[model samples]
Target: MGSSYQLQQQAIDAEIRSLEGSIRALKLRRNTFAPISSLPNEVIAIIFSFLRARVTLFAIKPGKKPDGLAWLRVAHVCHQWREIALNQPHFWSHVDFTAVSSAGAAEILSRAKTVPLHLEVGAPVGLWDDARFGPFQKELQDRVPHICRLAISAEPFHLHRILKGLIMPAPTLEFLSLASENDHRGGAAFVPDSLFDGSTPRLSSLELWNCDISWMSPLLGSLKHLEIRSPFKWPSLSVWLDALDQMPQLKTLALHRASPVAPWGLIPSEVERAVTLPSLTHFEVSSPARYCGFALAHLILPALTSLCVVAESSRRDYSDVQEILTFVSRHAHGPQDSRPLQSVLVRSNGMGVEIVAWTSPDVHVELSEQISVSDARHSGRVSFSITNSDDWSPRVDTGTLSAVMEALPLDGLVTFTAQNRFNRQFWLWHAPKWPLLRHVRLTPAAERGFREMLMEDNKRRGGPLLPLLKTLVLVDVALLERRNLRLCDALTKRVEQGVPLETLDLRKCLATGHAIELLSKIVVDVLAPEKTYETGSDLVSEAGARLIYVEDEYSEVEDYDEDDADTGSDDEVQDMDGDTSSDIYGEGEAVYW
Candidate 1:
């Protein structure tokens, strides 16, 4: 017992000694560090403030190390950090409780103090019920009037209670994003005008996804930016189009992503005359693959600096290219001060191709590329967009694609983008030589045609195929059964032609070992002839491109069905412009091999 008492006394003595040492150091060092300690409090506070806000309150689940996660990890470093974190009330408002717990939520809200909050709740339907939120609900209700922004993503049933329970109004709320990934969860009743009543006098922006709302009420007056997706199934587009007529202050409007196959043509003027929105400047509309159907020129904003149309391409050939071309022509900036209708993105969903143009002409392509000896020599980042470059389809081959690339002016383009722009069969005249070409993006089907095109048999008076081709990118390449003369044969032919092929990059997409074996042949043949093709178990093909191949094994899933492939939505309606919406497109017949 005497020995145990000695041990406990020794621990107490050590703690007391440490405290005395700290006190002695503080008293002696106060004068020496006075200048540093006297630094501006606001600046010191900012430095500490930065440390506090770095704590991440929410991370995207299945969380990879993104910026959000990195920021959150910075908070747990030390004791000083924990103190600075609790002191800054604004830091608590940015708390994202997507995958956090209820208790964690209360802690976050508590730390936020009385500062206006920005709350984003992304929880599954069952997780955020009125009962589940009962404890925080009342507290949130009490704090609602102080909230600056509130974004809640829940089902329709829960949304009703949430809207009703919102502490009798947030007059300062400025932004709201409400939706459910599960479409059936939101409807008109959940978004009654009373939700955006005078209490929310400052609400300026609204974004909806898979929300079902009829905009027949008086919620349209002061909105500056209004975005709607899946406009109806809450009812119809007409309900909101009716409200837009009265929104005099509206500046930006984004329509729902229309069905790829739906007969959505240029809406005529008479239909648009219902509302005169003189203040509108930015407009985004989703169209079917082709640009033929709908017209929006009548409501064209005189002050419009940017116009974006995401059109579905029905006719792969140049039938309505003129219509889209004309729309672009009509909307191009006239004044030098005007924004140069700059970017255009054409993505193919199903067979219905989408053409979305960005109005800022000065913008570079958003796609990345390989830097060449030449690009490095020039300087800076080389961005490329599929829509800006040549044809970027997943079902086309690189070697054969060169022919299509022949039509573009490639003097300034990078080699790979220049090569892909004309996916496979690049005509000899266009690429006379591959300067920037590095990779070719394609699917297994294109791989087959590519192999066949390179066969000693496919002699069509063309020289060697894709001599400069190096890599192949499969963005959404699906892992499916093989159809081939082998990727080995394809690589070997490039080698035989003395063409140097290097990497077959399909990092984002997957293929089989057997497919990998074929790609691995570049070293044996093209890269270093002394090397041999080492086979592996990888599939060659991936599926993002719309494809339909008539072969031994066929499944509805394997077929690249255009969104237009099969649907009862084909029954058409005439637009206000006296144009037959169905004239340009008809039924989808089986495509023969």
Candidate 2:
């Protein structure tokens, strides 16, 4: 009888717990349906806009249901939310019929009403069946007037076929980017002449890739940004100038692999007058050397802030560089002829040299030479190198550098770099010309010549070569010789005299531990080579003084390949493991090559 009573007591306890849970659930349900749930439709719509989904609508293929979307989530929240969402036409203005069924497309269009649309439409690659795009094309044709932005990427043939006889009613269109997709035949498509019927008055941005469009098209008058890539044939210089004259408001222009009507070797007997692009601020041209040369010579841009010139073939000509200097000389003048250029970056490879300026990197220039310039975001750097030939003279480089120095205002220059084969003696002689320079980076060969200048400055006892230099970075500088030691002593004396020599980075240097430690005692921060060597501070100097020992190790020689370096192009850079390149310079540090 006692055991039966215990089991009955446990059953009563279980029943009490179940009743408590039921009461808590009832309270939660009551809170969910409180009076605050009756929000105004306008308030609900504003909130929904904040939570609206941004997706590539064209990525949704036909017959596939899009699950877990923001609009769907809101509609399923409650009956009130469902009613509000279904009634708001703007909520469904962005339609992707490519992924949904015909019935779904119809409902979306009906709900969107007459609101402006941003359409991403095209028959995806490999869908040769015209039946697949019947419903999609019909909807696009009907909604042509409402599309403000159109981005289409499809085969040229298919694109032409879709809009052959259809008149585009795109009066409100502002931006249009059309590109050929997977055209293995090198994008030789003849664009229809009457495609837009001379419409698109409001089109300000136009980009055409691998499609031939007449330069005389009246529809191109209002374009502000223009890019033509892989044209079927090069237009004559006169024709190019005529087309440019029409687009007076063009701000940015880019031409890639665009041929010229004139053949390479024959110069036109009649020279076309240069076009004055008062509004153009950024320009880029990549073509054969002759074509690039002619274009640079004939274009006059008083407002050009950024420029990129890519010579596809290897042939050293100073006229192109001279033309660039002349163009800069014309624009780089204030009322009193103040130098407008703040910085000039010049880089060279085995083939040739590339010279650029630091107004902005709105323009990307690629050349056969491995010269490059980054935008304002990253530090602007230019690297120059030449073939290691004894007979190769620096005359060409001398003229180039002289032209650059004359064209730029060096009063604002803070950082400078003279790297491999950069006419070291020439730079050393001219080092004192710029007084405000603070940071300097030099390679092993360049540093050798720089040591002489430092010694000359030390002898003066007052003026220094770089008086304001605080941090020094030297690449592949080995302090194994007596002369190198004296140079270090001179630098140490400069630091002792309150020049603020805070950091000394001796990258890939060959030096004894005692030598490094002795140098470290003089300088605040010393980055010696990471090498395994004797660690002793008892090395007797030439003056018979013992110095602290520092253990140093040598790392593998870092090789620099021009082709492998980042040219700052739109193309993404990836490593063998699929990782991308990262920024090398940190905040507050100067960028030098």
Candidate 3:
């Protein structure tokens, strides 16, 4: 009886297995008839490539590992997808050891076949210790000849070992980036002379962070892009010049705290010869003002289209500021002098001061439209930023800033934007320098001082200040009570002098009904916020108070975007007014009370 029962159970299990097989067959057949399955194999492979391309292995937060293999879920969707993904060697060419387990790494390597691999390893700090990294290290050592791009972020000891293992020639390598996870200066890793056995012919881009290499390394010969941050040691000025002379094809060079230290008793005549970088278009340096000035004095960039200098100091004297300004004045002309300076924006606060000059008026239009300058691409720009580290709430050095403005070649400037607070004296003193200025945008903090300057200029017996000024923009300012009356009086004086403003824009400002009436009467066209809060009873609405508070918070902040200088083409100016048609700023007609 027991045998009979066992036989019955076995028979039932066999039938269940048969049913499962049938079910899988039916699903496969159904998938074949689906819309996506009808796509040609090559088209399907292209779609898969795009999906894989979107998954990157960078920028993972702390205490987390990269999951770049998530795109492989497409292979599990159907049998056909699995076959297609396995057949395409390029799909599995990128192997991130930290993201995959030991078995998974083997599978990826097997599937990649002979395709040139783009390898990323040892990121997110604590993941790649010596024990767990041994097998992968061996694999990388064997595959160095096939790597196209390699980026590794590891601690000093581990990086040293990894570099020692990479002694073979890497003829296929094009891009290489090495970073030390340890922040201590003493913990920087040393690059061995045998790296790629000094035989990387295709190398074009190299970035080293906290790594020390010889200045005359063969790997630095023909690089097009070079970025070094926090190097183990700073070379002398002459050594840097010699290294730069080797890379005439370099297009972008960025150094963060990696510039040469200032030598004592250095005279201008000692380093009269400047290393000319003819192909350099974008140059950036962040260091002490003295070091930055010393570095800029020794290099000549004839093809430079973008320049960025960030100077930080604790001294009261601003001689370094003058040196930097001199460099900018020399290079303000765009590449080959094809584009001239057209717009300038100055932003200052307790923490720092930033000045940006562009060769196109459209940058001002884009700023007026509230597009972040950091995201825009342009051809010509010169930017400067200086900060004081002694005091967080220190007063702005108007004396130094005035010199900076005076040094700028503003004869061709057409648009100017001033943000944050500047004392009345600063504006009154420098207002006349911008004779060709046509468009001006002033933030809330700047509005009062600028109004005072205009009023004071009216009192003088000379010509009107900013005689070419056509458009005036007041952003996040309060136009209520006494402030409104004083500003209107200033505008009335301008109108009386026969230099009426063509357009008046009040953006995100709280104004009483009487204020808009007075402004509309003086300006030909008024652009006010869509929703205006009339504070007739001296009671502010919640939203209006919130706006004022936000503006106040931003008043002491440095709002300059560095990326704006390196981007934006000549064609982007055509769409600068794309946001003007929106209802946020109301119609182009006057706003009645």
Per-residue CA lDDT of model 3 for 299-353, tens digit only, reads: 8898888877777765655555555566556665544766667788777533677
lDDT of each prediction vs. the true structure?
A: 0.46, 0.57, 0.72
TM-score (all chains, Cα) for each model: 0.54, 0.63, 0.83
Report the Cα lDDT for residue 204, model 2: 90
| Model 1: lDDT to the true structure | 0.46
* Per-residue alpha-carbon lDDT of candidate 1 for residues 173-221, written as tens digits (9 for 90 to 100): 8777777545344354346666645357788887776665546544445
Residue 283 deviation, candidate 3, in Å?
A: 0.7
Tens digits of lDDT, candidate 2, 94-149: 66545566678768888888887766655567665766566767877788787776
Flag the better candidate by TM-score, 1 or 3. 3
For candidate 3, the lDDT comes to 0.72
Ranking by TM-score: 3, 2, 1
Kindly indicate the candidate among 1 and 2 with the higher TM-score.
2
* Worst-scoring 10-residue span by lDDT in model 1: 380-389
lDDT measured at residue 20 in model 1 versus the true structure, 0 to 100 = 95
- Index of the highest-TM-score prediction: 3
- How many pairs of residues collide in model 1? 58
